[model samples]
Target chain A: MDTEEIYREMANSIVSLDQEKAVHLANQALDESMDLLQVIEKGFGEGIRKVGDLWDEGEFFLPELMSGAQIMEKAVDIITPGLQSSGSERQSSGKVLLATIEGDIHSIGKTIVATMLKANGFQVVDLGTDVKAEKIVDEAIKGDIDIIGVSTLLTTTMVNQKKVIDLLNQKNIRNKFKVIFGGAPVTQGWVDECGADGYAENAVESVKLVKELIQ
Target chain B: MLFTNWLEDKSKIILFDGAMGTQLMNRDLEPGKIPDLLNIENPEVVKKVLASYYDAGSDMVQTCTFSSNVVSLNRHNISNLYQKINVEAINNIKAILPSEENLIVGDIGPSGEFRPPVGNASGDMWKAGFQKQAKILAPGIDLWHIETISDLQEMSAAIQGIKEVSEKPIIASMTYRKTKTRGFFTIMGDSVETCVTKLEEEKVDVIGTNCTLGSDQMIELIKELVNLTDIPISAKPNAGQPRLSGGNTLYDQPVEDYVNDIGQMIDLGVKIVGGCCGTTPTHIRKIRTLIDSR
Candidate 1:
């Protein structure tokens, strides 16, 4: 197949959530001496972007969205080493620290955001769920992260997202990183009320919000 | 005390209690502390929340074991305390009940773990997690209530797990978001028809929707549910969409307004009703007045 044909098949593989096909295409592209970064950006990345659009349009749901992300991740795994061994690494958009704020054990929303952010070229450090504000802020400082994404699916735990921002300001380093809020209960108004930099309603929007914040 | 015949009085509407997480916060639960731990560490608080609901005329109040299931507890490194948490959660409610006439729902929330294609967890994993909790909670509680679940697969596993342990009446509720496409759907993309079909196939005593949508939004969804299922329907919508005020999350839907919306739900033939996130005893009190006056 031609280079463009291979890329189309790769994109289709993710759009269909066909992981085996995506992996096969990734390997085929490498064997044909294709540019690995192009395989990712034009092929798998294009597919994930389409999946995100379908998610936004309500044509896709959480399972489809997460499955698409997982497929993209697997395809990228097959392609990344080729780029690295060839010393042609793709530039990351920015680094983000993601967590489900403390007191909330819900992690699906946060995990979807992490997967989408990673698929969209952001380096993500997931702190997992029930993370304390101190630990979140401490990691933000330690990692020199560009953005902190705090999420809580429970209404009661929503306060801890604000707590993370408060801890940052208490340390007098609020300006050092952009803080974005997410989860079912978070709103744009809540983000503003809590002094957060931004809020995204879902995983698809999280990528766009994180990108705009870093910019 | 499986009250398998609990719904025999078709004329009387069964009232479930309001939100546990909301009451816990009002009682000064810290931002990061696990709510389930309160069962073992602070039984009084859990009892107080249930007592207020009972006083407000809730015929049935759920135990504070929503997040004590193995999968969720494991995330907090308290998986070993799962059985203990479930036991104490039921004990706390039993201690405060005014009489045996009032029902105690053994509340179960989602496992927070997803199955295949989307997540690594399997149906068996979900079944095991729920079964473990059900075994501990079934002995004390009168019935089982599984709520706020998004995936039908998980719901099926929950039903199987609970049924494996006891013959309690199961109230299966899934949380849904109102879509712009003229219907309500769970976040997992299960449509109302799909939800109704699954719950019916599982032979649950109650089929309903809860969380995400407010009472106003729930009116339409409950209307749809009433049309689809002959089984008793439950509507436990959020007080409304939560809004942040002064750095604390609050549900701005007023008690009168919330009860009014619930009234519409009752008119549409909803049998089991209560609040979800952000509801308190005040909302339940008004609902009690509405039910009695009706």
Candidate 2:
């Protein structure tokens, strides 16, 4: 297959959740001497974006979204090391830390945001869920992270986003990194209440928000 | 004495629990806030409500600890206060009644998320949360009511925790959302047959249903459930569907309307019948009156 054809096959495989086919097509696309970024942009990114669109439009539900995301993750796993090992001059993006706040166990939303950001060339360090506020700030300080993304599904737990922000300010780390928040009960009002720099309604918007925050 | 044992030998039908959340909301619970916090911060209000439920003929009263899990508490900025929160939750429930016979079911509720390792809540975290809450609650509780559990993953975690410490009979129940306006499936898509088979392995003393659709819906689900297992079934349904009126949640079906439907749940082999969302002492009294006469 041609480069574009190979990339399209990889995208279809990921969307279809045929991990082996996705792996094969991605490897073929890479072997065809396609640009690494071009392969990722055409294949995994578009596949995940299509899955997200289907989810938003109710054509796909949670299980399908999960399967599609998992496929994209599998594809990325193989492609990432090749791209990194090649030492090619690539896009310059921002650094970000994302986590589901401590006491909240819902991490899927945060995972989606991190995946999309990473696919778009942002440096996203996923802290995982039930994360302590100190650990978040500590990571930011240690890694010199540019953005902190906190996710919480419960209305009561969303307060942790504010708590993390409060500790950052208390520890004299507020101005170090921009904070963005999202999840089920996280509103635009909550963004102001938590004193976060930005908020995204969904994963697709999170990339735009992170880019804007860094710029 | 086991409520189920007492229930099995007795000729009279059971007087199940009452509308815990609705009664709790009436006592000034904010939306999405842990209602069990009232048990600690304002014991008198919780006392009045429970006493009212008992007086209203509710033989069984669940403690105000549905959202008392550490995961849910941290949501409300009570992360460092897990022990205090649960201790107060138990003590407040103890303060409401004088004796062990009046069974205060320690409510071991869900974390509102998928189970861990694959999800965010690690099995260790879930166990730790349950252990901390149960350590304080087990001493005061006559029975540990693992109520409103939706998924098998969480139920397994909670059961594993309870068996580690307390020997109290744990009553496991789940909430089912009606897919077709009275479907026999849980919110997570587990059917009543699946629930019965899985719950049997967990070794819960009393297995049942609670906190979903109204009496009619509960009856439909229960009837479907009867074909699945011979396990002692408990049914505590909502008074009716929730409706938004004047910016407040209201169940259009009154106490009598709910009590009127109790017979159907009973006919479906519901061993224990009570109210859930819209129930109060008044509804329980009517239920008691209805059950006693039958």
Q: Which candidate achieves the best DockQ against the true structure? A: 1
Chain B TM-score in candidate 1, rounded to 2 decimals? Answer: 0.97
Give each model's clash number: 0, 2
Candidate 1, residues B1-294, lDDT tens digits: the string is 425555777777888999988789878887657788999999998899999999999999999998888987887788999978988888899899988779989999988788765567889989999999999999888888899999999999999999999898899999988765647888889999999998999999889788889888888888788888788888899898888787566777788999999999989998888999899999999999999998
Per-residue lDDT of candidate 1, residues A36-148 (tens digit) = 88888999999999999988877789889989998898888888888888999878999999988887878778888999989888899999988899999999999999999
Model 2, stretches more than 4 Å misplaced? A1-24, A30-67, A73-215, B2-4, B10-12, B98-101, B116-118, B178-189
Residue pairs in clash, model 2: A156-B75, A157-B75
lDDT of 2 by residue, B63-179 (tens): 888777776566556767777767776777677774555778888888755542124666667777777778878887778778777776677788888888898887788887654
Model 2, A20-133: lDDT tens digits are: 898886676567666777777886777877776765554544455566766777777777677877886446488889988886667667876776677566778899888888
Each prediction's TM-score against the native?
0.93, 0.67
DockQ of each: 0.56, 0.08
DockQ of predicted candidate 1: 0.56
Interface RMSD (Å) of model 2? 8.1
- CAPRI docking class of candidate 1: medium
